[model samples]
Target: MKKTITFAMLHFGVAFTITYLLTGSWVLGGAVALIEPAVNTVVFYFHEKAWKRAESKQLPLAA
Candidate 1:
């Protein structure tokens, strides 16, 4: 969770800085900011699902 949030924020900051420099418009920068979190959420969701599936396959035998 923390890793995902950090990754998202880093992406947003870099993108926002670049967009602000190129466009000089906060509104556009704000719009660009939305992309990072959306992408991060999708990535994290899939990552979690994959991890869960892998973990489930590793169960030990019962007595």
Candidate 2:
């Protein structure tokens, strides 16, 4: 839990820093920092589902 929290903070800080560097707007940087991760989490749920489906479709090798 502690690791997860720290990683989340690191992610937000990096996101904000990069966005701020590019755009020079605190509002946009903060918004992107918050929104991108939430959206990525949702996208990741479907990404894992797709990966699982693809893995299930693979044929096993015969020894």
Candidate 3:
């Protein structure tokens, strides 16, 4: 989707900017920009799964 692509670009730019600003290395910045999002995606998937499992275990309320 266009929105996803644009947001990904925005995330990459922000990550690269902050890392580069702190470390003064484009290579490290680029690496983190790519790697952090990938790691975050995996983490997010597990986080969602955990949340779903938790929600499913919740008891229903009585009327």
Query: Highest lDDT, which number?
Result: 1
TM-score-based ranking: 3, 2, 1
Q: Look at candidate 2 and tell me the lDDT of residue 58.
A: 96
Where is model 3 more than 4 Å wrong at Cα?
A: 1-10, 61-63
- Provide the RMSD of all predictions against the true structure, rounded to 1 decimal: 4.8, 3.5, 3.2
Residue-wise C-alpha lDDT for candidate 3, range 1-63, written one tens digit per residue: 454456667778888999999999999999999988666656666776889899999999998
Superposed model 2: Cα runs more than 4 Å off: 1-10, 61-63
**What count of clashes does model 2 give?**
0
Give the per-residue Cα lDDT of candidate 2 at 8: 60
Tens digits of per-residue lDDT, candidate 1, 13-62, equal: 88888898999999888888788667866788789889989998996989
On TM-score, the leading prediction is: 3
lDDT of each: 0.82, 0.80, 0.81
Q: Go through the candidates in order and give the clash count of each.
A: 0, 0, 0
lDDT of 2 at 23: 100
Error of 2 at 15 (Å): 2.1
Clashing pairs in 2: none
Order by lDDT, highest first: 1, 3, 2
Task: Look at candidate 3 and give me any clashing residue pairs.
Answer: none
